[model samples]
Target: MDAGQIVEPPRILARRSGDGWVLYMDGVEPSYVRRLDGAIERGRVLMEAGKVPGVEHGAVLKIDLGDELNQRVKTSTQATADAHKAQVAAAAELRRTAAALNEHGLTGRDIAHVLGVSPQRVSQLLNDQHARG
Candidate 1:
């Protein structure tokens, strides 16, 4: 290899079709990935195993999976963050509701029954509310 010459990372084309991800690399076997993280992991495994055609062992691999796949991953990540935010908000609301119910003369057991949670959980929520205040 000439000095300063650009070495392109071995490219693997990946796409989600139907239920799974399909991957294609030059001179290597076409493979399918089932999970969301499986395509990148598959590429890494191939690169480390010296299976990406002419690419040597430990060569960096480029996943040229198109914009659609990238968008899907980005959207999924955003959705996860959104879900976490919603979960936090819901927990905060539960704490407030539990405290309010306690002030309205509801016992821990009654609040637990109304919220479909254990009495211990209701007590914990009330404690959390008090701690925050």
Candidate 2:
């Protein structure tokens, strides 16, 4: 995230960085969302499903540029989440491929070599797969 880049606001709570004024939204996933329609949709769905205890429609305190959370913090959180999600997915796929190679009579070392990863990484991948179950 670069300086001056606008980010998607939090769905729950926010405080204006410039004025220190707090803004809140009421609902309960789209709970506290910036989008009124999203909140209403979630509430309606929950109510229809009898999942929510109660529902509120289209309530908002204020919706600013979403300067509530520190920009750096928001950037870091989003970046970390994105990186971890990608890593989890990629690691799972790599392990699946590695297992397939192993089933084809490839040694762990052989799989590692073909996959351009460390032999230890092959073990890690296998361990991760076992852990998943």
Alpha-carbon local distance difference test for all models: 0.77, 0.61
Model 1 agreement with the true structure over 28-102: per-residue lDDT tens digits: 677788755666567657665755543543233345457887789789989999999999999999999999999
lDDT of 2 by residue, 8-87 (tens): 43233444444343334343332333443354354455443543332333222333454554676778889999999999
Worst 10 residues of 2 by lDDT: 53-62
Winner by lDDT: 1
In candidate 1, where is summed lDDT lowest over 10 consecutive residues?
A: 53-62
Q: How far in Å is the alpha carbon of 86 misplaced in model 1? A: 0.4
Please give the TM-score that candidate 2 achieves against the real structure: 0.43
Please identify model 1 stretches exceeding 4 Å from their true place: 1-64
Give the local distance difference test score of model 2. 0.61
